[model samples]
Target: MKKNLFIGALTLTAAPIFAQQAVQRPNIIFIMSDDHASQAISAYGHPLSKLAPTPNIDRIAKNGAQFWNNYCANSLSGPSRASILTGKHSHKNGYLANWNKEFDGSQQTLPKILQENGYETAIIGKWHLISEPTGFDHWMILDGQGDYNNPDFITDNDTVQYFGYVTDLITTFTKQWLQTRDRDRPFFLMMHHKAPHRNWVPAERHYNLYEETEFPVPENYFDEYEGRFAAKNQEMNIYRDMYEGHDLKMVTGIDSDTLLFDPWPDAFINTLTPYEKKRFFEAYRSRNNDYYNTDLTEKEIALWKLQRYLQDYLATIKSVDESVGQILDFLEQSGLDENTIVIYTSDQGFYTGEHGWFDKRFMYEESFQMPMVMQFKGEIKPGTQVHGLTQNIDFAPTFLDFCGIKIPEDMQGESFREMVVSGSTPEDWRQSLYYHYYEYPGIHSVRAHYGVKTDRYKLIYFYDEDIWELFDLENDPTEMKNIFGEEGKENITEELKKELSRLQKLYEVPGI
Candidate 1:
């Protein structure tokens, strides 16, 4: 596998200066999961991570570079994925919101470019863009948000149902492709996962994990949504919005409020084998019965629900972490570890009880920040930490640049390959990031909003109601208080707005 080495510049001091050689491009494996938050990842140092550690994910960061200021252009799965594929924002890629949107496959994308440049490209996992994947020699994707158990996959030929946990099946397909691929050319693989998403369902092995553990409640669990009107009206709160039977898995109550929500729990469990179902119920039935039978106060119920939710969610991630270790192990065993660049990231971040919420759509710190860790063995220094800002849009350009392919002029993202290699941010790197969310009149009832964030301050504008909020992130990392119009802060607010305008103009986005 080391035969596909750099074409020129023998030293690995920085990104290689390579020509148009078909045989020299490095293989890249992009491992992305749905809605896996940075806080849950142990590498990012959130206290919750100590409770549920992810050693495999932390390995990538320890072995190479971890970006502390990584963000997504939009916080939803589809939009963030589109931006990553095209190195452009949501509006440019034309997949604004999730529903009623199909990715325009004919457009230029990273996979297409890599395929054109003598790389055997394949994607085997969650593709929620609602269109036949283009630009890859092979693709096998989930059928929209994908069932966690015995899921169906849409291949180039036909849709086939696989009998196993979704994470394991996806990992199997990825390894199978690698094993039987045309090895003359370097390979680029996108191994995506659907675990740890909504209605969290763990693999059979992880069903009993965290059963006895009680996760500490977030300090802002009882946040009153003071001063921020948009926060007050959201429908994503864990206590307020999660369905009783579907989310909490407490499925045997008489009241309508205690029933499961549509399209989960029942849909997923009914597909399992009787043997599997018996094991599943054996793991959960006693706890569910205890919850439904015992009398509890309102606060107790909320705490119980939050604890249960974390247990299930974290359990789902355990399988994903295992899948990552498998891929890393394969690379080492097959001698591909030297040249293959492996990345671990999520489509977007989620709120793991931050602001007492479960879903993501807001420009708040919890949901807006995405986790990005990469391993390039000799090129990137171990323990490298990048404080400079990077966004999802930068992914396509960075991959192209690393592969010695010319990035298209139309891409709105800048490559940060050299910065990662040198373990230092260049002085000219981006100082701030821009974010937008347009899924309003939609799920979670979060209003359509856009915002800008520098190292210290953040400014958000909810367009529907002409609302504006500002936070001094340096002073308030949790973003609990909105300081939009406080005295002596007028200068910071005005400057953030100006920077927001500059970014919008530079990106060719129309001012809101």
Candidate 2:
């Protein structure tokens, strides 16, 4: 088995803030889930809002502000995570893709900066950066693409397999760590969860949730990919790309050796102990049997997969919601709520059959946008919402800002602390957001591309394919029609290109 473990020396920076201030510093708990889409959370009010609601995640919105225009600098897990950690784009951070790349732990990161400035820092759960975690006092994480049930965790001491659902196990470790952490000093905790990722395994308790619920198929679920070449070329289409026995978790009896198509790996299931395997396999036996016994047309199969996909995906999220509620309850009961900054977000947005897709890579809204909510009791106004464009790059700076620490000059993202405190958009805030994705010759076959998204329009360039696509988001929110060369769109296209060029230069990224 390939090991994804990195251990490094711990370096402490000067405790600049602690030396200057006598006031109590705020405690921060950033909770992130893997591949969680905005539409899946009811707080975003997407098409599936009514069918599956996230009450616990909504609590953060109800109590604080919900950022509707939040996004990831890069849609892939490792790249986005690297951006969040170092407050720089993938190019500067040197973690451009998920596979065969490890984060440069020697570089300054949020946890390191905070730890240097007199805050106790710890991270538990999915740390996919692939480097020995540095700057943290305590850190525990799962191996790459951790299993959903009874996952193994890598800590500073050793790798141990914990019994229970992965989501529940992550929360258990988080709570346990919080309970024993130094209470006198303020601390920062990254409680990351690996739920709702690929394979979409739910806890046995939530296995049946949404099973009877039929999801509203996205309007573009059967997208013909009329204009965009990249969309047409992707390997993530719902009907053609998703694997039967793996992605949908249906037990297709076709032997890998006999079948022409490659089989999904059962390594995750193989990791389970005898009893764990028995209970888990038995729970899905009837469902798998039912799926294999049925026959359907292409469209029917697509719709069936959509339903199955959402049920399992949302069921996993249900556990994450419960975990959020448990954390909130702990904060309130322990009096930490009064001074803590609680944030709920995801690594990146995912596609729930949007544009006939199941993964995130495209510059489309469904894949590029992320769900973010933050509550800082008595500091930020309750029920406030911000429409300003924020990216994952801003996270590190924002945390440093809240701690009253001077953000490092090399950090590329600006802190949104002022806007959160004022409950209004800053007059000088950015008007357009820049995005780039580069993992080609990689999975899903999403070509390397970059784009800029403004409130009214978007322009993407598939540099490798040398194709330009533009959309008037105000009119074509689904982005079904590409209007790059349309007669009246020339000026808008030119304007977007100008902004994109400026952003690339400003961020020091390679120009188009």
Candidate 3:
């Protein structure tokens, strides 16, 4: 009888430990915003960013660590997101560019690994990856750059259009899923936003938020493209190439004067006096319709470009911030805040009139950097800033690390959990980061190039041109001065070449 009582006591003692271990698994909520740049958010301290402050995005940084040097392996939407999911570069994953490439769902991903470890996974929002999202228990995604107003969502069963704005609708589904999902198991939810993308449409509520003020321009807005041949021919120029078709058109009625002018009949205009009709024709001409007939003199026209750009961009971001607040609020109300890991980031950085360019696909700092911030309530130390070299490829391993799942050997990135949890970055980490930009002569006239970025210097090789460009980042942060092929930097250039070659071979890149 004594033996039986002792056995029961032993079992009771072990029960609490087992229950504690089971409950320790954290819920992960990864929020990704399309085409969002660190420059747009006030948290990053861009001089022109006060126009639309991303307070909700700032909230994540305020509560946890914001990575100062986070970057994407490739600087396009689909390719960058693919790297995040697979923890592999575009070349390794077979998704180098945006054309005709689909994410193969059969490969190992965070969702699949988390699901295998007994977590309920649901992805609600923009899944730009071409394949049907595999390994997700429940998924409702947008069908290829979903509309801002009355967007359509593709569910596991069928495609359905939901009324209201895309950002609000995505958040509605996220909240609904949180309420309906199984409560016994932890959840991994991806709330992706399609706002602040091309054609920059803002919701009705944010339409008039920044209408009165003019946004300031970056110092490099009028870059002359002196040393860089690729910068001379980019397609994202606002003044030269932005059109009224497709994404840029406003839903509101376009002004008649903005339309292409048709030559008036000879008989009709002969009767009108030259002086009386001079003002009328001038007002109605397409050339004068560029700035909505505002008195933007030549000097102001330069400033007006940045103003119009930010007004539309910030307006879209305003709605995105509101949606982020809603998600954070829902987590708090559901008592999931303590156990949930919230991450806010963009697929890639964007240009806000920097270097006279707007789109990505260059290894330049503006296009290469991505805003990465995360908050794990109890697991990660609050208000930590990590300066370690982290990439989108590191995201998959980090997620798996949080869930205590085994990271597959094939994955290319190492988990940064130790850096986040302990608040101490590792020394002698990656001395340099490998970069590649494949989309060439497509949208941005940037040539296909691969490069290496060390702490102080950068070396780029434009394969098509067979030209190499090197920049001393410490001396010229704006990348204005190219020290490559210059006198007295030969030894430094040679050393960087050897380091770049070593990295290419270490990463198993072919034909280094």
Which pairs in model 1 have colliding backbones?
none
Q: Which ten-residue region of model 2 has the weakest summed lDDT?
A: 4-13
Winner by TM-score between candidate 2 and candidate 1:
1
* Better candidate by lDDT, 1 or 3: 1
- State which candidate, 2 or 3, has the greater TM-score: 2
Off by over 4 Å in 1: 1-23, 253-266
TM-score of each: 0.94, 0.93, 0.88
CA lDDT of every candidate: 0.88, 0.86, 0.79
Q: What's model 2's lDDT at 442?
A: 92
lDDT of 1 at 66: 96
lDDT of 2 by residue, 1-512 (tens): 12312211111124435433523689899999999999989988876856888999999999999999999998999998889989999888988888745788998899888988878899999988777789899999998777777778998889998877889988998999989987546899999999889878888888777878989998889898999999999999878888775677666452211112326454456656777657766676665666657787777878998998889899999999999999999999999899899999999999998888998988899889999999998889999898888999999999999988999999999899988878888999999999999999799999999999999899999998999999888889989999999998888988999999999999999544
Global lDDT of model 1: 0.88
Tens-place lDDT digits, model 1, residues 273-367: 88887777677876777786789999998889899899999999999999999999999999888888999999988988978889999999888
lDDT of 3 by residue, 1-512 (tens): 99968875776586866446547998899999999888888888886677678888888888888888888898998888888878988877878888746888888788888888878998998988888999899999998877776667999899997767788898889999999987657888888899788767677666557767667777777788788766675677765555432323321223442223213222122323465235334432333345565666755755565566677788888888899889898888978888889999999999888876677888888889898889989777778888888889899999999888999988888898888777777885676788888887676566888999888899989888887889998998888777889999999899999988987877788755
- For candidate 2, the clash count comes to 1
